[model samples]
Target: MNKKPNVAIVGATGMVGHAFLKVLEERNFPVKDIRLLASGRSKGKKIKFCGNDFKVEELVKGSFKDIDIALFSAGAAISKEFAPLAVKAGAVVVDNSSAFRMDPGVPLVVPEVNPKAIQRHKGIIANPNCSTIQMVVVLKPLHDAARIKRIVVSSYQSASGWGKEAVDQLWAETEQIIKSRIQHPGSSIKVDGVKKVLPAQIAFNVIPQIDVFLPNRYTKEEMKMVNETRKIMEDDSIKITATCVRVGVFISHAEAVNIETEKKLTPEEATEILRHSAGVEVIDDISKEKYPLPIDAAGKDASFVGRIRADESVENGLNLWIVSDNLRKGAALNAVQIAELLIK
Candidate 1:
């Protein structure tokens, strides 16, 4: 058998980085040497892999010397700084940041939707935004079957998408609410819970913002889905709009998607296609109340599609809901899949 490739996971201590380890192991990808790279504070921390301890290394300019493929999930700034160095060192970089997604030369890839796009990469390939990734993966096959004229998406994103600090904020605020409930059973803020943390508390409430707002009033996360969908699907004519909101859930980014198709498809037809679609699972069954939920989808790799119905107002419109572990398929698993493509 051929030797397994040497791989490096940048930001190995972050949420997405930790998910990458699980995806790689679950898929049984051939990994000869796995280099775990993190920040200075995390360096020397032991990450056990295959029953052996691997010390995390601090990321530096020369860290990619012998790495064959680098999966980067640190952040956009770090990717902007070090991705090129990894490429120069002869490693194909699969970056999970927005730094290069819209770059004309770099391919924004979702393996299930556009694996062929990987062949056009110039050393660096970008994974689409978490919300965009699952939406497109579920929509692409249908779009290819019947052209998609317009797409409207609303995202219920988890705090973990913002990284560990945001996750901590959610948990802390939640615990505070629980304690308050126990102390003051009849208080006004009892069931509603706390509503402000970091300018807006996300305890038992949903915040209508996920990232910094742009001049157009849409958050950066919304713009990512709008632009990145066109680039990844290779269809600039597909009109897209999005509203991303942060939810109180611990994991899984869920989306309420509505698409106007050039041709009509019944709910059954759509569900049939989604069930067999690559990397997607159709879990719509109203009679038995079997549908995808955020808690049910947490930690799973596949994007779940449910609540499929035809829009009565529009001529050829379909409405659906989708959920997936944003940290996995949205970030880590997609980046790791790109590395697998390079190895092939």
Candidate 2:
């Protein structure tokens, strides 16, 4: 790796792609040069970074030439096609897609959880799902203190997790609902439009499904959390289940995570452990009603944990509320941290 690497960002016009640039600049990553590449439609678009305007070029086989680190967020299909090309071009890819995450050859990494996995990458590293990234960061310290046996998590994900279009849909539907309420009082509020991104109306509603349902009746997003958590923790024996939901918020994801550990840990003990852990912020204070909220966690890199309590149903059960910005720590920051490790 170069002391000052030349980087390329695939999907430069997308939501997580924009986040990649923001986090790279905020952390002052050493970069000799940068190339912004996207789909053909986004070609010639101008994106400002580090006080300079760069034109977005259409991604192709030649895009990875002379690039040291390539951060990919274009999606699984694009990654499956171009990631190998990037690696063949001598640019190590840190992909933010599911294309190679479950591959035995790829290391699915969250810097705060399994940073050592970065060293084992064979020219390509995989970033876990956004939901999985935040949950695992909070789970690692607790799992180390008392080995986790089983996990049950329910995610309240924001529209931003889908993409920029989903966010626009949320606001558009919100405005329509508000106008209907104001004009036709005592009538049902309805949103009128052909829904494009989300499965159902997301305005003032929550959908329990994220990705397509599998034969096992679990959505793909839910299964990703279950599998990715075990892989990152390196403990296949740890039983995991998840219910992913899409909420009306525009940014940040919140999860209600319940875990059963082999050994008991009190709320105070767990709080102390997480407070000292890297990439975790303890925000629990029930008396004054202070806890992790999606609004408060937006644009932040740390995984916020709160609502610490003991589940009385099980012998060694603990509950937590975890929150983080889906685009930052969940996707861009995690990939950037892996690149940082590569440079180190």
Please count the clashing residue pairs in each candidate, in the order shown: 3, 0
TM per model? 0.94, 0.97
lDDT of 2 by residue, 1-344 (tens): 99799999999899999999999999999989999999999999999999999999999999999999999999999999999999999999999999999999899999898889888889999999999999999999999999999999999999999988889888888898787665443443445563558887788888999989999999999999999999999999999999999999999999999999999999999999999999999999999999999999999999999999999998999999999999999999999999999999
Question: lDDT at 341 for candidate 1?
Answer: 77
lDDT of 2: 0.94
List the pairs of residues colliding in candidate 1. Answer: 196-201, 197-200, 197-201
User: In candidate 1, what are the lDDT values of residues 104-199, reduced to their tens digit?
Assistant: 999999999889988898899999899999998999989988899999999999888888877877887677778766433333232234333343
Candidate 2 has which clashing residue pairs, if any? none
The numbered model that scores best in TM-score is 2
- The stretch of ten residues in a row with the least summed lDDT in candidate 1 is 188-197
Model 1 TM-score, all chains together: 0.94
Off by over 4 Å in 2: 182-195
**Model 1: lDDT to the true structure:** 0.87
Overall lDDT per candidate, in order of appearance: 0.87, 0.94
